[model samples]
Target: MKNYWTISRKFEQNMNRLQKPKKETFKKRLQNYLIKFKTKSPQITEKYKYFLAGFIEGEGSFYVGLKKNSTSKYGLKVDPAFSVTQNKTGVVHLIAFMVLFQTGRIDFKSGSENTYVFKIENRQSLVEKVIPFYKSYVLPLTCSTKKQIFNNWVNVINKLDQGVHKTSEGLAYEILPLVFASRTKGKREKSLQDYQKLVLLGVRQ
Candidate 1:
């Protein structure tokens, strides 16, 4: 009877060992996961896109640059640009803005205080990519002031495409006035009244 009981106990122990799960190493678990996992590029979601647009409505600037260039037909060149400025605390939004557009460059500006700016300066990118993306996703929801400025800026760009900014008179009478007038109040010396004064004064070095 003692021998029979001992043999039964040994058999039960063997059965428990066989039923227990095996311990796996971290590397083995990761390897198993990789077998089923696939990697792809990161994508911008629609919700983030709308958030960026609203953010821009508050902090962005659409600028049209008119600078003296004697070699050009107008003796001035039109440099149309889009930019958003923010403090260091707002750097995340700036980064997201860059990612959404996937085209501009980030820069730091130092003045009375330091700030960061994400700027799009390339004409091709502005007209083809930046402008269209905003037109479709952002512009429709922009506020009145921003909408007015944006509309004027786009018109100037379109006119530039048609070669309207190629002559000195054209730049003085058409482009400069439109650009300066579109900016927020108190930005320039004054409004369209100072357009000629600004042009004749030449750009400050």
Candidate 2:
């Protein structure tokens, strides 16, 4: 009887082990969830898309930066970026943005513990994914202020795409004016006159 009971217990343990589900890694689980989410109805997906656009209209930014870089033939580099910021408590939405856009990255905002930012700075991603997505979805829903900013930013990006910024004349006359127009007055680090002076200096060098 003792031997019989021990054998039965061992058999049950093996059965339990065999029946237990395999544990999925986090990446696998996330991929599965995304697959399921994508399989949702088109109406549902469209709603989500519009929701993201509205969220961006409220919280997103379109910006172009002029940073002095001596390594370039031009005195300044044109840095265009699109970003949305949210607190850590809202990180799930930020992740949704990354998944939807198929580009950009989410990171902890500098100097803040509970803040995060989703940003795209890659020129290709900006020109391809970000810009198209905005024009199709976000642009239609944007307010006047944001609309102007987006248009100005797009003009800068188009010039960069044309390789027009390679010449000092292009940087000074064509690109710099657009950059100045894109920025909010009084927010720039240097005056437009200061930037033109730097461009002239670069040509002299």
Candidate 3:
């Protein structure tokens, strides 16, 4: 009877040990899965570059946003951005974009769950990395509407980079028109005339 009791106790101890959970075991497994498919380094090859460009062609956007700013020389700011959106299932592709571009960030898309966006809004990054990459790999493969929008976006970026948006005349005659033209016709919140009026007011001030 004593021997049987001792053997039963040992069996219980072994069972408890096996039942205990390992710390971060699931997390580590997930990391390993992601690493398996993602580029481990920023020095990706030309094939991956073209793959990313094609991905962008279907899922990417080049946007120019206008916002009213109180302290600006023209009472307006031109916000230009490049972005690609994907659901959580495809987040590994977005991670590859981060690795390849060496700039931009991934964020949860506003107003939705399980959606992610890889965005580059920094002007320097746009000029140095995003713009050049698109011009080389993306532009040649874009559809007509996307191609036109991209060209307009590039013109806007170039103008802002050159300080051409500082004067009211430049804001009205040059920058604002491009901003207006870049959008789909019915999607504009304010008309070009309204923006021109604001520029005129800025000039009067």
Candidate 4:
């Protein structure tokens, strides 16, 4: 009877292990999540498409009151108490996360895809860095290997660890590209340069 109990215990343990996500299941889920929200709000999906498509890589539900105000040039007051989940889950949300990081706005109603400002002009550079990394590292991961999905989760956690978590003002921040106003200050600035600066700031987290 003791030997029988030991065999049953081993069987239950193996069953439990099988119940968790396997390598193939994880890959399938990741693909589905990436595809489902490519154009939807909570824009992390779109942002990561660029990351997943090329590079293979790379918040918050806190109610801390944002001391909202317009810096003189931007001439606009920001909203207060933005919400984020990426920080809590430490899970990267693609496009919406970028917009949230920039403007401190989590709600889809506040976002403007057409008007959203970004300074990721170095897209090519990022792509250059990411392509090789994905090819060398992430592309090798798959279901045939033991602990493959587990290893990939660890890699993701490590990557998110490197992301922005604070602003210059010391508020929490994200990786959304920020366009800073040219300090070169346009002389007699008859153009909308200052507004452009605010737009950058508004979009800059």
Candidate with top lDDT is 3
Candidate 1 structure quality by residue, lDDT tens digits, 1-205: 9999999999999999999999865345434433422322234688878777776777788988766566654345678899988886666676666556666755686572458887888888889878887888888887787888998898888888888765646667877778876677774544564545545555433
The candidate 2 region of ten consecutive residues with least summed lDDT is: 35-44
After superposition, candidate 1 runs with Cα above 4 Å error: 1-43, 112-114, 187-205
Model 2 residue 56 CA deviation (Å) reads 1.1
- TM-score top scorer: 3
> In lDDT terms, how accurate is model 4?
0.34
RMSD, every candidate, angstroms:
22.8, 14.7, 15.6, 18.8
Question: What's the TM-score of each model vs. the native?
Answer: 0.68, 0.74, 0.75, 0.22
lDDT of 3 by residue, 1-205 (tens): 9999999999999999999996544345445545754634334679988988988998898888888887787788789998999998888778777766666667789998889998888889899889889999988877898888888888999999899888888888999889877776675677988988888787423
Candidate 2 per-residue lDDT, tens place, 25-61, comes to 5456445544643532122277788887877887887
In model 3, the clashing pairs are none
Count of residue pairs whose backbone atoms collide, per candidate: 0, 0, 0, 15
Write down the lDDT that model 3 would get: 0.81
Ranking of models by TM-score: 3, 2, 1, 4
Q: Model 3, residue 28: displacement in angstroms? A: 19
